[model samples]
Target: MIRLLSIFVLCSFSLNAKSISSNDLRSLYSKGQAHWPAIQTSDGRRVEPMSLLPVASPKPEHVALGDKLFHDVQLSRNNTVSCATCHERDKGFHDGRTTAIGIDDQVGTRNTPAIFGIDQWQSFFWDGRASTAEQQALMPIANPIEMDLDPKIALARVNKDKSYHAFNKSAFNSSTLTTEQMAKALVAFERTLAAPSSRYKTFLTQLNKNPQHAINSLSDSELNGLHLFRTKAKCMTCHNGPLLSDNQFHGTGLHYYGRRFEDKGRYDATQNPEHIGQFRTPSLLGLMQTFPWMHNGLFDDLAGIVALYNHGGVRPRPRKSQLNDPHFPKTTDLLIKLNLTKQEQADLVAFLRIL
Candidate 1:
């Protein structure tokens, strides 16, 4: 009886061990080896892991001073136009106009792109002439038609204000202020301008957590839109990764007023012949707010922009220009003949607005 009892006990222990092993294999297969998560890519390779990126944080003093400088009209020569005049916060920090109009009712050649998510951009301006947001922040203040203020005069104007003086004393420890200091503070504040709470961000986060979880979380329309954006529309080619831009230049063969001008874009900076007519890829974030699309602000509505892309860029050529391929579908030879139905176009536009 004792020998039989021992044999049964040993058999039961072996079965339990086998069950645990099988369950472990099932878990690994479901969540690890066979389950490849969706990852953002560039040039057909996965983007650098987000864990490698530095976490961004802003100092309170810098944010406070930046808010003041952003809103203070005194920064302008006429005290009539502030940064907010062109980059209104309520409007995604971009004035809704075909071309930006400044202090003396002077119009700029380009549309004011939204400042949100600008911290992630490697370069600034449509031409990418400015490499840093700090340097770019000073341009509008000194532009003849924009703010029209000498850095010295602008600093002096701010210094005269008692409230500003107190803030400066607490923030910088000296009553005297300079343009460089002001630029740094503004840039620091702008660096903190990130939008990570969007629904898309939530989806991406869930994706990173678990691929199946992300797939399960998405709505049917969003999934369809994502598929189209990646495959059919080819938007992921240029607007890739977490920030939604490749930070590269391209020419969509956009004709301003039916004529090409001396914009020259990145060519002016790089002096590369191939770069002519190329402009930096702007991020699609806040697309619902920033309008009058393109570098020259030619398209007044999103529909026109979408239609232009559907046509495989404005004027398709046999040989692709260096900058045009990413924005245009490569598989199709027909110029602007995406054959996208009206509903697809609407769906694509809706997806863009969500970004």
Candidate 2:
């Protein structure tokens, strides 16, 4: 079974930690062979330049069970809502709504970010509310607007389901599903929801081998856009590394503290005062597929988001804060006006689409 094999692989790593690197963990889990559907370095480890992040390891048996639970509406009070309602697979694992529409037609303030490689994330949620995906999974089920089911009720529902018994046994080594067991299973499944390979990745791999000819793969404009993204755009500062995310919160000066929908962003989580309007830097993995950008979902197009950066903060610092602090904090300096030309903006968008 996948569960037994995964555990064995991890145990092997434990017994011989010095012999295996974290990079080797994934290959070993795949039984030392996996066709990742992308190009690779000469060393055999694959590369996906689009996301720049390695593909995650094989999902465990609990992941299969979690996939079932993700689509099952039984987790909701009215039995009409599920995790998939917000993080659907068809639309790049996001509901594509400006804001999340949950049970009883309740709408959330922030947009539902498309789910992806959060297993490598240092924090979870738009505001960095939960430190881990396991903790984040538990909150939504109990939130009034979401599933609207208490933890006790959710666990009880699974307890009564005969089909879930085997999953609980395999995942938790128990006959009944516990809170910890369910959260872990869901996180395991979410880890597998990575962005698929794309033409951009193929281009990057080719470039690794033949830089001169590889430049012919993407259009001249796209190549110019890639250069701009790394230089003038300077996106690699925050959106860097394998996952193309720094996993840090940033304030973009989009503080709607008193409008129709007011979100405190990260301040609600840490109350550090400095975190007032800061939000986690989401990845650019599936940006072309997931739209209506930003935490407010106000910007409908990637060009709009790019323009916002081109012109610096859209709005000046809030005249006041709901937190009742004088002299509100300024938006991140990274948002400084780039003063890019129209053609450059179009070029950047073309590069993003291929990702």
Candidate 3:
């Protein structure tokens, strides 16, 4: 009798569930309304249309100084690695490595995030430890596994560089240079690296003008993928807004706690039990350009990632020893099984590639 009732409830839900149309999505996005079948995050934020501001316009001298600083290897302890080494422009500002290889070929645990569109971010890094760009800029230089160079050493090196003298003076309007001024210059240059306009943006523009041209803007498969992204795929729940990220942390069950691959994630920053497996939700702006996704850079192919999400993310069973651990992170309830068809998964991947 219970089995029969469960079957009936499943049938009822299947009958009631409706796929959201592209036109409906466009209409709601235009008006900033939450599309149906969407839910508020723990913080009460919902999916909204991406609204990017024009690229920030900082002083030309600051940008020039920052550009030089970004490519300068003298800042590293061994004079080998520079900021651009990890954030290559052709690779969408990502190093394309499974994990970042730093000074002396040291391997860091976390993936290198892209620098694109970072000027708009409130927090920096996978753990969200750094609150400002200045703070974020200086951290990697001194990281033991990274550049392994002291900020004081970096400052002295830049101060001694004759080529940087004019830019340093122009950026700070002073003959004397400081670490804060250098960080501000780096931030100024990075802010200018905003993502270029995409087909998705063009589609949205056409939708605002008239929904007819949206078909011409995107392919049938891409459109279907967009629909699935919002509806069945449930991507918009966390990856929404102009940046396509909620800028919040949620556990996707990849932390591998109490195991050899254990990564404490945001818990390392806060030391809070609730944040054990959580990492910042990265923007999907340059999704395809950056490869080896996730905090650990575990998955390289988007198809595999889609499959993971289709099965409602990785739900690792706790071992006998871990069963008693109170901080064993549970994947967020937002990741319900998607049940996407193979074709639907392909379509979703198609849409993601264009992103």
Give me the candidate number with maximum TM-score.
3
Q: lDDT by residue for model 2 over 189-287, one digit each (tens)?
A: 888886655666676566556554555666756765655565456565566556666677877667665565556789889888788778887776666
Candidate 2's TM-score reads: 0.80
Worst 10 residues of 2 by lDDT: 4-13
lDDT digits (tens) for residues 37-113 of candidate 3: 44333234455754553568889989999999999999899999999988888887889888899999999998899
Which candidate, 1 or 2, would have the higher TM-score against the true structure? 2
Write down the lDDT that model 1 would get: 0.60
When 2 and 3 are scored with lDDT, the better candidate is: 3
Ranking by TM-score: 3, 2, 1
lDDT by residue for model 1 over 263-310, one digit each (tens)?
656766787766666778776665656765667665555555666566
For candidate 1, report its TM-score.
0.74
TM-scores of the models, in the order given = 0.74, 0.80, 0.86
Candidate 1 lDDT at 178 equals: 76
Question: Cα RMSD (Å) between model 3 and the true structure?
Answer: 6.5
- After TM-score superposition, the amount by which residue 128's alpha carbon in candidate 1 deviates from its true location, in angstroms, is 1.1
Error of 2 at 158 (Å): 0.3
